[model samples]
Target: MTAVALVLLAADFVTKQIALTHFSGSDPTEALGGLLRFTLVFNSGGAFSIGEGEAWFFTTVKIVVVVAMLVVSPRIRTPVWAVSFGLVIAGAAGNLVDRLFRAPSPLQGRVVDWIQLPHWPVFNLADCGVVCGSALVMWASMRGIRLNGTRESDAPAEAGATERTAEGRDR
Candidate 1:
């Protein structure tokens, strides 16, 4: 899980760097002629251009969300849920890094978003991971999957241990 998280974080960072470098001072170009485009835009806010004038608010929000996710992620019993949480965390971490240290200001840093698709919002790799992970977690939860450390047998063992403890206490 840690490995996956690291990979996703690294990939997101690298791709963002590439986007920043490649499209620094040029108009967004469609590499596939309207299918895909490498566009350079600074998102000082949230998804799809909303909250376009606030960066600090979004940074604080991300921090709170990441912390919450970390606390809840470990309690998820299923591997799928864990991985999905990991993906979301990694992606959030990548963007958080940008928000903290990219440029212009601390915690007021803009996210460098590129990679446009037809009729979709312009986004980067981290956003992709977050969205993908969010969908997976939602699906897993809908199917009644637990994504925590507790195993199915743990309950029975715990019950047995409690019985033993009760018996010992009565003696």
Candidate 2:
């Protein structure tokens, strides 16, 4: 989990720096025959530009998420769960860094977003991690894979079942 988080965080930081240097104040650069574009944008809001001018609120939320994930990480024995947690941690931390250090003052700084696709808002690698990680979290929950690496079916029998079995044995 640590490895995955570190790698993703580094990747996000490096890519954002590159984008800032190359794409800032420039028109969107086309790629993949116009299927993708690098369009630099500094966002002071949440996803899709929602809650504009609420950078402080967003920063607080991201900090809470990162801390909560870390607190629960030790119990995530399942590899998939670990990876999902790592991705979320990295994503939240990635954007939190921008909020803490970028510009316009701490906790009110804008996040650097560059990648763009047709009919989609300009986003960054951190956004991808958050979206993908959240999907995995949902999948694992629906499949009954617990954080401690146990499936629901593998757990001990319910208390009622155990009581019924004991009653029969005493007959």
Candidate 3:
């Protein structure tokens, strides 16, 4: 989990720096026959630029998410769960760094976003991590996989049988 988080965090940081250096103050750059574009954007809000000017709120949320993930990481016994948590942690921390240290002042700074697709908002690698990680977490939960790597279907049959027997007697 630590490895995954660190790698993603580093990648996000490096890419954002590169984007800032190359894309800032320039017109959007197109590639892949206009399928993708590098358009520099500094967002002070949440996803899709919602709640603009709420950088402080987003920063607080990211801090809480990072700390919560770290506290709960030890109980994740499955690789999938570990990766899911790691992605989320790295994503939150990546954006948190910008909010806390970037231009405009601490806790009110804008996040650098440069990647854009047709009809889509300009976003960064950290946004990708957050979206993908959240999807994975939902998938795991729907599949009944627990934090300790146990599935709902893995529960002992004896417990179900005992419950049935008790219900029969009560009737």
lDDT of each: 0.82, 0.93, 0.93
lDDT of 1 at 31: 74
lDDT of 1 by residue, 73-123 (tens): 656666787788888889888888989997789998989889889898888
Which regions of candidate 3 fall more than 4 Å away from where they truly are? 157-171
TM-score of model 2 relative to the true fold? 0.92
**12-80 in candidate 2: lDDT tens per residue?**
999999998889547889999999999999999999999989999999999999999999898888889
Model 1 per-residue lDDT at 137:
76
Pick by lDDT: which candidate is best?
Answer: 2
Error (Å) of candidate 1 at residue 6 is 0.7
Model 3 poorest 10 in a row by lDDT:
20-29
TM-score (C-alpha) between model 1 and the true structure? 0.81
- Model 3 lDDT vs. the true structure? 0.93
